[model samples]
Target: MTTSATQRQAAASVKSRPPRIADRLPAEGENGVFTESWFPLCKSSEIAPGEMRGFGFLDGRVVVMRDRQGEVHVLSAYCPHVGADLSVGKVVGDQIQCAFHEWRFNTDGYVAATAIGDPAPKACLFKYPSADKYGVIWAFNGETPWWEIPDFDKPADALAIRVEYDVPIYPIDPWVICANTPDWQHIKIVHKIAFDHKQYRDCLVWNNYSMQGRLDGYYTDNKGGALETKAGIFGTSIFMMQGNIGGRWIGVMTPFGIPKPGHTSTYFILATEKGDGSPADQQIVDQTLAGLYHLAKVQVGEDKPILRTIKYAPGYLTASDAMLAKYLKLVREFPRSHAGGEYIR
Candidate 1:
């Protein structure tokens, strides 16, 4: 057969297959930085008052420090003077004192003092927009954050929050993991979640920076129970779920971090409403949170096999995949920047 006829025969024979597409969505557009989203660096407990720790971030590094006054700060890791890793230094009062020359740097990323007594050179560290929330320390990629970290409807003080951070890093882009939120099929198949018969267009409420929907049904897994979940995927790196499990209120917040390209770190924030200030009430609240934590672990465990190996391309999507399609579009349009490159290096 001729080349054209052979091509026609191949097309006619193929029934269904993954469509040709990009490997993964664009994380860094023309700007050469990960999407402008809040990235969790480490747990708040890791950096105690008057302590500092360094972490690998999007194509760079950062140091997290808590001052003597118990305020947390995130800044570029390397010192301007002779390029020392500031995390090796000591936290002196509100400033970080570089171990090399004992150069003291303030939270604003400017040189505060130098042990050598020379006029402190006009040097500065890249101070990332940082926050301590959901039991994790987070830093935004851009100079200013587009939005704050999301919270449950109730005030934080009204809730009991427990954070778990021992999860293994996944060999996938952060956004690819966030895609699981709208992947209804995976929800039903992997996590045994059976949602009521409602389409994405009917349930999803999309916004500029987030999308949320409610799923109501029972887990089809052997240990079945009723599930009423309201979940949101925010800024390509955070997921929040408020739900009723076993007739009790449960809340989960999962934030993803990119240690570098093709790798993701995660934290689990499990929460429940506070009860009356009685020992018995506290015990009940504790048990509820423990159950929620176990559930979160089980669901994530189910996802590990696929996420670690997925070379994500939307491929042959159907009408049922409308939610995933919408999410991908938002990810592409999301802002990106490498503003900290100069200093974080």
Candidate 2:
């Protein structure tokens, strides 16, 4: 059996990438970052008013801060004056005061004041277009964002109770995570869950996001009163579920790529329809909600082991892989992050 030179080179390339998250920049002609898309900067609840914190984005870190008025801002973490981590500094009024030199930076990234109590030069920092929605702070990697986060099927003003769960870093590209949403075979086999699922391509009405769709599944292990659970996926970043048993419940996973390439973190953001209840009944409702949250957490846990050892290579396809093939095509066509523009983080 002779292995051709091309085949040997392909094997070697796969071997080169360590199991750890890919940290190296993509070689020339590779699309490393998807621009004109929203990458989560931080959770809205985590950044309190008059507070500043840093979170990883794209291939670098961005500092998220809430001003006194509770407006969130995302910007480069470094102080352009002296390279100090701006997140470590304090927020004064609507601006951040750098600890190293007391330099002040406004939400617009302009140098407000210098260390010597003088107006600074024209040097300014980079600011990203950010918005607070879906219990997360979203920033556009490219300016003039091409798409906005889509809303759930529910009403625009429904009182959805949001509970967010922080997921640990997993070593996988964002696309890989999104691809798992429509894996019907994995549901019936690996997870031991059974349900009817049909993956669809994003076309007219919902062309805002990528090629991923809903998973309508119910746990086969359970006895009578089968629970009705519905999931919605938008790209690789957001996975959502609406479950009905004793009450209505919804869960969303808003994932974002970190400064480390090929590594991503997810927020298992959960929500429930606010049921009217008295103090005594509210406690019972809370307990039930806790169980649902745990279930959602467990489902996310099941994916980690698979991602840790997965490789990017050609696979023998069958009729079952029909949807996955389309999903990959959408991922490939995703726009690349550009070097200029406000989004070039």
Task: State TM-scores per candidate.
Answer: 0.92, 0.80
RMSD from true fold, candidate 2: 6.4
lDDT against the true structure, per candidate, is: 0.85, 0.64
Give the range where candidate 2 is weakest over 10 consecutive residues by summed lDDT: 199-208
lDDT of 2 by residue, 206-241 (tens): 343654344445566552124455555565465555
Give the runs in model 1 whose Cα sits over 4 Å from its true position.
Answer: 1-19, 28-31, 197-200, 222-224
Error of 2 at 198 (Å): 4.4
- The CA root-mean-square deviation of candidate 1, after full C-alpha superposition on the true structure, stands at 3.0
Q: Which stretches of candidate 2 lie over 4 Å from their true place?
A: 1-32, 155-157, 160-162, 198-208, 211-214, 223-230, 243-249, 257-259, 338-345
Q: Indicate which candidate wins on TM-score.
A: 1
Q: What would the per-residue lDDT of candidate 1 be over residues 171-219, giving only the tens digit for each residue? A: 8878888989888888888888777636544788888789888867788
State each candidate's clash count.
0, 1
lDDT of 2 at 143: 52
